[model samples]
Target: MLEIHQFPCLSDNYGYLLHDPDSGETACIDTPDAAAYLHAAQEREWQITQIWNTHWHPDHAGGNEAIKAATGCTVLAPEIDAERIPAVDRIVKHGETVWLGEWDAAVIGVGGHTNGHVAYHLPDAEMAFVGDALFALGCGRMFEGTAPQFWTSLTRLKALPPATMLYCAHEYTASNARFALHADPDNAELQTYAEEIRHRRDAGQPTVPSKLLRELKTNPFLRADNPELQARWGHPGDAVATFAALRAAKDTF
Candidate 1:
């Protein structure tokens, strides 16, 4: 069985520690803070054997060198961003598979938030470690990619099984809920989910590891193809145009 440990790091970032008991291999996905990851691993008596980075953003790969120095762990990241992530030991590309003990994780190219952003999808575990690409109720802002490119990336994630659990890097659900309501105001599921998100945040709980099915029902960014949202945003029938309009609105919103 694969055991995942979740903890807060660097303000809103959430760190993940994936442990495979069968082989005693553990991997840290996206190092937001090396000290936090080290402490968490020490508390669990699990040594970090590898690091799977999803992007080259400072918040995502900031702890790479520190963590690698401490654990002598192997670091794997997208080859396209190799120059940005100096600590990467193995360069991975899209459609490649990496093994964590006996479990396999498919590396999916999801370039939107960053030019080389990727997602590590463990189909067998029904989980995905998406960095700043896709979020719980929102998607990442296009920093280095275009709206159409981001839309493509989002569609790829939407293709995953509805039951798949997504682990995003930041704690942006509370704010995302607000935007979702604006874009999908008439969606009953979104209204309910927004309330739930508010309740969770008010109680100081993390609204992460959200189910993909729930996202499909509530996330406006993921529902760019919905005619209602398109009409509400006045983008008519073009999904890409609707996505760009929403994203532009979100840039200032």
Candidate 2:
């Protein structure tokens, strides 16, 4: 079994260290903070051996050089964003596979947040390291891709097994829940889920690693194709248009 060590670093970023004990290989999902990642690995007595970068964002790949220099780990990043990311030893495209011991992770192209954003999905672990692509109740902003492209990216994620656990990189669930409720005011499941998110935040607990089953029913961004959402957002039958409207609204909201 792969062991994941999650810890808070920076202001809202969640650092993930994926460990495969059988091969003694540890991979940093993203290099949000080098010092924090190094300290966390040291405390757990795990040697960092690889880095899997999801995008070119500074917060996601800023610590790459430092961590690599310290651990001599190999860095794998999205091929499309290779020019922007630092110290990438391997550039992986969508459908390509990366390995940690005997376990394999598929690279999923999720290019809305950034033009080359990618997600690492481990089918065996039933989890995905989704760096700012899909949030608990929201998706990343359309920084570099079109709504159609982003919706397409999300469609791939929505196709994942319902039991898949989404390990998003931020702690934005509370705020996202607020927007989700506003977007889908009549969704009873969303109301319940929002309330749970509130309680989780009040207790100072992390709301990441959300289940795909719950998100499928609640995340407005992911529900753009639903007739109700398309009608509600005034897009009628266009999922891409509806997604565009929702993203525009959230940017100002």
TM-score of 2: 0.99
- For model 2 the local lDDT of residue 79 reads 89
Candidate 1, 1-253: lDDT as tens digits: 8999999998899999999988989999989899999999999999899999999988889999999999999999898887898588899988999999999999998998898999999999999998989999999998899888989989989999999999999999999888888877889998999999899999999999999999999898898998888898888788899999888888888
TM-score of each: 0.98, 0.99
User: For each candidate, what is the lDDT?
Assistant: 0.92, 0.95
Residue 186 lDDT in model 1? 88
Model 2 clash pairs are: none
Q: Flag regions of model 2 displaced more than 4 Å.
A: none
Q: Which predicted model would earn the best TM-score?
A: 2
Residue range 1-253, candidate 2, lDDT tens digits: 9999999989999999999999999999999999999999999999999999999999999999999999999999998898999999999999999999999999999998998999999999999999999999999988999988999999999999999999999999999999999899999999999999999999999998899999999999999999998999898989999999999999999
